[model samples]
Target: MSHLVIDIGNSRTKIAIFDDHKLVKNDVLEDLTEEKLRDYLKENSIQQSIISSVRDGIERLENVLIEQTVYIRFSAALNTNINNQYKSPETLGLDRLAGVIGAKALYPGENCLVIDLGTCITYDAIDNDNVYKGGSISPGLNMRLRAMHELTGRLPLIPLDDFDGSEGNNTGTSMLSGVVNGTFLEMAGFIEQYRAQYSELRVILCGGDANFFDTRLKNSIFAHTLKTEPDLVLIGLNEVINQQ
Candidate 1:
């Protein structure tokens, strides 16, 4: 049977079609409309649908999903085989929980660290006991750059491009180094810290910036443990669907 999963985030939305847990189609779109959902349902024999949205005002999208297929509303309370120990279960990001769920599916009983790098970078950890004690969240690459531009009078909004390495000679390059390289180093540091605590830690990277961070960290000290799973959230969302 076919299942559809959609993750609605701050900047964009991701839609994935899974054929009994095997991903069949995935797409990222800036605008999510009823027509798009209709088209997807129209093109495929989607049997069930699930959605996890971080942004509010998705009542319309929810309506469309309910209309299209046997919709399953994904949330933290869904019957997933994991222990969610977050202090504020109501406030916990479903995306974060989804990442943790994805990591659990990959590692099963082992400790897992999920670093989702998107509009904002989020770190989530689930222990070998399947207990999830939330991680940290920080500004992502573009958000950092944008903050420098909007928050400061001097820093200009610089487009993301190749980082030239050397501490950057000019203002723009310096911003690039601090924004991009800084993020890499920050992730490296997190990996280092988590690895120190959890010896059998399996690091899973996801979100829009996962590939870039994954490639950049390949030669780092934590390379052996780090894994880049771009479709992680979708996988977790699918897990939620199947578990139910």
Candidate 2:
């Protein structure tokens, strides 16, 4: 049977088609409409559907999924075998929880650190014992750049493409270096701290900026323990369907 998983995030929506446990197709779109969802359902023989959204006003999409398939509204209460110990489970981002679940699903009994680089960079950890205590969240690459421009009068917003990953000689380059390189150092520092606790920690990178961070970290000492799975949230959502 086929399953459809959708993750609605701040900037984009991710749709994945899973044939049982294997992901057969994945697509990222800026916006997802009911008509577009209908096209997917028409093209594939989807038996079940699950959605995890970070925003509101999705009732129309929900109605379509509810009418068409066995729609599962993803929330913190859904059991995916992880022992969640977050203080505010209801307030925890479903995407973050899904990332942790994705880590567990991918690594099984291994200690995993999932770093999602999207509108905001989130760090979530799941121990080998299947326990999730908490994680961290920081401004993402673009957010940092935009913040610099918005918060300060002198700074201009630097584009990610303009950054060549080098020491800055000019104002724009300096801002880019500080944001991109600084963020990398921040990530490295977090990894170091997590490694101190879990020596066998497996770092999984996902979200829009996953490839960029993967490229940077691959050149560093963390290459051996690093993994990039852009479809991680979708994978975790699929796992939820399987567990049901």
Candidate 3:
């Protein structure tokens, strides 16, 4: 049987097709219209669909999925293995759940740190015990740059790009240093802290900026002895939806 998984985020929506637990195809789109989405679904032999959306257009997408398949799973807050140390569990984002699911499935029997670098950079932890302990979230690369520009009068809204090295020379470069470099350090520091706590910690990085960060900081312990799964969230959503 085939499975379809869609993750609707703040900036973009990702669609993936899975045959059973194995991924068949994946795509990222800026606009998600039901008509276009339905046309894509026609190509896949989908028997079920799992959707995780932070946006409001999912009701329409749900109708499209229902038109194609009988089983349509929409992720929501639940008494899951993931510990909700956060004040409000319902407020937690669905993308985080997808990342955690990916970590659990891809790196079973290991303690994993899942970092997603989309509009908001999120860190989630799944321990060796299979307990999903919550992690942290911070402004993403683009958001940080935009925040600097919006909050101040002089700072310009710069694009999200990594400097070749740790240092940046010019003002624009300095902004990159403060935002992108700082983000890399933040990730490295978090991984270091986790490593101190758990000897068997394994790191997995995903999202749009993950490749840039991974390429620049692959020498760090977290990046060196780690895995980068770009389609981790899609895979996770597929796995969870299939379970139901």
Estimate every model's Cα lDDT from 0 to 1: 0.86, 0.92, 0.80
Off by over 4 Å in 2: none
lDDT of 3 by residue, 31-100 (tens): 7898877888777677888788887657888888887787555544543444445556677688898788
User: What is the C-alpha local distance difference test score of candidate 2?
Assistant: 0.92
Residues 1-244 of candidate 1 have per-residue lDDT tens digits of 8999999998899999999879989999997898888887888888898888998888887888787689987777777898887888889898999989888887888889999998999989899999987899999888988898999888889877666555888999989988888888888888889888987888888988776667677777677888889889999999888888
Strongest candidate by TM-score: 2
Q: How many angstroms is residue 208 displaced in model 1 relative to the true structure, after the best TM-score fit?
A: 1.0
lDDT of each residue in 145-225, candidate 2, tens digit only: 999899998999788889887899999999999988899999999999999999799999999988777888998999999
Which of 1 and 2 is ahead in TM-score? 2
Give the Cα error of residue 165 in candidate 2, in Å: 1.4
Worst 10 residues of 3 by lDDT: 75-84
**What lDDT score is found at residue 174 in candidate 3?**
88
- Please report the TM-score between candidate 3 and the true structure: 0.92
Best by lDDT: 2
